[model samples]
Target: MNLKVSKEAAEWYKNEMDLKQGDYIQYYVQLYGGIPTVHPNYSLGVSIGKAENIAIKDVVEGITFYFNSDDAWFLEEFDMEVVFEKEELEFIFHKK
Candidate 1:
């Protein structure tokens, strides 16, 4: 997929996300609406879909990049309480 990441996300992907070359970075890209799962509930949170992970190849966008299952599942079940803007950040590194 063609993930569109913000400058902040790009920096995270390059640094924080710890992405290598082929890891899987799960993300719930915002296409429709509602605040991201990570962000706290907002009067203007986007009403998109449930959070999911995207392999490095599929992750085209999102802010919260998960490194392990705990992070991924926590994000997947994140309550709308944190108000952090969402953007794409590649985190998953696929194994060859």
Candidate 2:
């Protein structure tokens, strides 16, 4: 998943959002928990769709992926980018 932050949001966010893939997303499905809403820094969720890319999932309002967490557990490692656009931020999940 590629998360980009817009300069506009970054001004206030500073460091608001974190995207990670952990065994949790997979495990949660078993327990019937889709996306965990409990994140240490920010509450997180995923866009729901049969879309091939997870990024295509609903980009939650007021959330953007600006940086990755070394401490953030993910299914695998990915790239992080900060966008300067003031428009809505959308995450594009490239299938690995």
What does candidate 1's lDDT look like per residue over 1-96, in tens digits? 122334455455546545454444443334345433333342122122224443322232333333233333333332212112555423322222
Q: Identify the runs in model 1 with alpha carbons over 4 angstroms from their true place.
A: 1-3, 6-8, 28-96
Q: Count the backbone clashes (under 3 Å) in each candidate.
A: 29, 4
Q: Using Cα atoms with residue i matched to residue i, what is each candidate's TM-score against the true structure?
A: 0.26, 0.25
**Per-residue alpha-carbon lDDT of model 2 for 1-96, expressed as tens digits?**
444444553443333334232211101111224333223233234331222223311132333332223323442344333334545443333334
- Report lDDT per candidate: 0.34, 0.32
Q: What is the lDDT of residue 56 in candidate 2?
A: 18
Show the lowest summed lDDT stretch of 10 residues, model 2.
21-30
Angstrom error at residue 13, model 2: 3.4
Candidate 2 — what's its lDDT?
Answer: 0.32
Clashes of 2: 4
